[model samples]
Target chain A: MTETASLRRAARRYRLEFGGAMAAYALTVLGTSLWIDANPGSSARLPVALLPVIPVVLVVVAAVRFFRSQDELLRRRQVEALAFAFVGTALAVITYGFFETVGFPRLSAWWTWGTMAILWCVGTFVSSRRYG
Target chain B: MKNLLRVLRTERGWSQLDLAEQLGVSRQTVNALETERYDPSLPLAMRIARLFERPVESLFFLDEDAT
Candidate 1:
C-alpha cells in the first residue's frame, strides 16, 4: 500500500478505538450520575463511581493498540515522545508537590493526567519533526 | 550514518512506498534511512541490501564524524 493509504488505515483504526472509548466513557458517566442522583447517598454510589474505570481501561487498551499498529520508525518516534512525557510529567508533579507545601493552590489529581496528555502531544510533534 | 536508499530506489524505478512494501516497513522509515536521520536494524538493513542485490556495506556507510 501507499504511504497515504497506510496512514489512513492507522488513523481509521485509531479513530474507531478512540470513538468507542469516548462513547463508553460518556455512557458510564451519564449512567453513574443519574444513578447517584436517584439513589441519593446510597452505599452503592462509591462502587458505581468506579464504573467509569471500565471506559478508562478501554482507553488504555485503545492506546496500546494504536502503539502496536504503528510501523517501526513511527513506533520509535512515539516511544521517544512518550518517554519525554513520562519524565516531564513526573518532574512537573514533583515540582507541584513542593509548591503546594509553600502555599500554592492544591491541584486535583486529574491535573497530572491532563498535563501528561498535553506533554505527550508536544513530545510527539517535536520528536516527529526532529526525525524528519 | 549515510545510505544510498534513495539512489537505489530510483535506479530500480521504485517509489518509497514500493520499496517499503517490499521491505515490510513504512515509507517514513525508508525516508528516514535515505535522509540519514535513522538507521535500520541489522535485519532490516540486510533486507534492504538483499532487495537491492547489494552488500549492506555497499548500500550504507558510517560517516567519519558518526564514529
Candidate 2:
C-alpha cells in the first residue's frame, strides 16, 4: 500500500494523462479556430475563451489525484512543482496581458502550446530539485 | 550520495522493492539512490542504515563538501 507512492510511478501516470489532455487541448483550439474563422460574423466569444479551460481542469484533477493519500515528502514535491508552474505561468500571462492591454499584438494561435511546454519542463525541474 | 544500500540489501537478499516497502517509499526512490540522482534526507538515510543493521557511515558516505 505504501509503496504506491513511488515518484516514478506517479509521474508516469501523470505524464500519460497529461499528454492525452494536451492533444485534446490542441485539437480544440485548431477545430474551434477553423469554425470561428469560417463564421467570422458569429458571436461565440464566451465559448471561445472557455475552450482552453478543459486542459486546465484536467491538469488540476491529475495533480490532485497524484497527491492523494501520499506521504509528506512526496506531497511537498508535487506542491513545489505546481508552485513553480503556477508562478511562472502567472508571470508570463500577466506580462503578456499587460502588453496586450497597452496595444501590443497578442500572441499567435500557438500561444496555448507554450504554456504546456513551459509547465512540463519547468515543473519537472522543480519536482526533481525538491523531490530528488 | 554514496550509499551501501545495494550492498547491504544484497547481503540480506532484499530487492529494491522490498526495502522500499519497508520504508513506505517507492522503488523509484531506491533506484534514485542507486543511480545517484537523489539524496535522501538525513533522517531517512539514518533510518535506512538502521533498517539494514549498518552504521550510517557504512551505509552512506559523505562527499568532501558534505563535511
Candidate 3:
C-alpha cells in the first residue's frame, strides 16, 4: 500500500479508537455525575473521579499506535510539531503563571492539556504546510 | 543540499505517490525530497538511487551556498 493509504488506514483506526474512548468517557462522566448527585458526600468520589481517566488512557494508546504507524518523514514532521507544541505550551503556561501572580484567576489543570492539544494541532498544520 | 528528484521523477513519468510506493515511503516524503525540505538518510538515498538506476552523486548534490 502507498504511504498515504497506510496512513489513512491508521487514521481511520485511530478515529474509531478515539470514538470508543470518547463514548466511554461520556458514559463515565455521566455515571460519575449521577453518582455524585445521589451521594454528595460519598467515599467513592475519589474512584469515581478517576474513572474518566480510563478512556483517556485508551486515547493515549491510540495516539501512540498512530505515531508508531507513521512513515519516517511523517514521524519527523510529528516530532517537529510536538516540539513546537511543547515549547508553545510552556511559554503559554509561563505567561499564565505571571498573570496568576498579578491576580488573574487560576485555571484548571485540564487547561494545560487543552493548550498542548491546540498548539499541537496548529503545529502539525503549520509543519505540514511548510514541508508541502 | 539539493537534488534533481523532481526532474528524475518526471523523467520516469512517476507521480510522487508512485515513487513513494516504490520507495516504501510516504508521498509526503517524496514531495519533501523533491522540494528539498527534508533530506533522506543515506540508506534511503541509496534506495532512491537504486530505484532510479543512477549513482547517488548523480541524483543528489550539495549546493555551493549550503557549504
Candidate 4:
C-alpha cells in the first residue's frame, strides 16, 4: 500500500476508538442522570455509583490505546489540555474555599461537580484556542 | 529543527501518508513537517530517523551551521 493510504488507515482506527469511547461515556453519564434525579434520597444514584463502571472501562481501554499508539503532536496537545483542566479546577476550588472561609457559604458537592463540568468545557476551549 | 524528511521520503518512494503510518501520525502532520509549517519534537525526530535508517543529526539539523 502507498504511504498516504496507510496513514489514513491508522488515523481512521484511532478516530474510531477515540470516538466510540467518548460516545459511550456520554450515553452512560446522561442515562444515569435520571437515576440521581429520581432517587435523591438514595445514595445509590450518585454519579460515581457502581452502575457507571462500564463507561470507566471504556475510557480506560481507549486511554490505553491512545497513549500506546497516538501521534506525538496530538499526545502533547492532550497533555496540554489536561494541564489546563487541572489549573482551572484548582482555581475554582481555591475560590470556593476562600468564600467559605469568609462569611459566604457555598453550594454542596453537586454544585462543585457542576462547576467542574463548566470549567472543563471552558478549559478545553481556551486551551485549544491557545495551543491546538 | 530543519530536516531532510522531504528528500529522504521522496527518495524512498514514500509519500507523507506512508511515513505517517510508520510514525503513527496523520498525513497532514507529515505534510506540515515537510512544508516547515510544523516542527517535530525529539521523540518524533528519533522515530523518523529510525524509520529512515539514518542518524538523528543526518535527518534533522539543530541550526543552519550544523550542515
- DockQ, all models: 0.58, 0.22, 0.58, 0.37
Against the true structure, whose lDDT is highest?
3
Binned by DockQ into CAPRI classes (incorrect, acceptable, medium, high), candidate 4 is acceptable
lDDT of 2 by residue, B9-67 (tens): 78889878888878777766777777666778778887887787777787676776346
Candidate 4 residue runs with Cα over 4 Å from true position? A1-50, A103-105, A108-132, B7-14, B35-47, B50-54, B64-67
Q: What TM-score does candidate 1 reach?
A: 0.92
Give the runs in model 2 whose Cα sits over 4 Å from its true position: A1-68, A71-73, A105-122, A125-132, B65-67
Which residue pairs come into collision in candidate 3?
A: none
lDDT of 3 at B18: 89
Quote model 3's TM-score: 0.91
lDDT of 2 at A41: 75
TM-score of each: 0.92, 0.55, 0.91, 0.60
Docking class of 2: incorrect
lDDT-wise, the better of 1 and 2 is 1
> What TM-score does structure 4 among the candidates reach?
0.60
Between prediction 1 and prediction 2, the one with superior DockQ is 1
lDDT of 4 by residue, A1-132 (tens): 433554455557767876787787787777787767777788665544555677667767866765655566556655666676677777888888898888887777777657766765676676445442
lDDT of 2 by residue, A39-105 (tens): 7877885698579778878977876777774555565566776677777777887889899998999
Tens digits of per-residue lDDT, candidate 1, A22-97, equal 9999999999999999999699989998999998898889889888877778899999999999999999999999
Error of 1 at A7 (Å): 5.1
The C-alpha lDDT values of all candidates are 0.88, 0.73, 0.90, 0.71
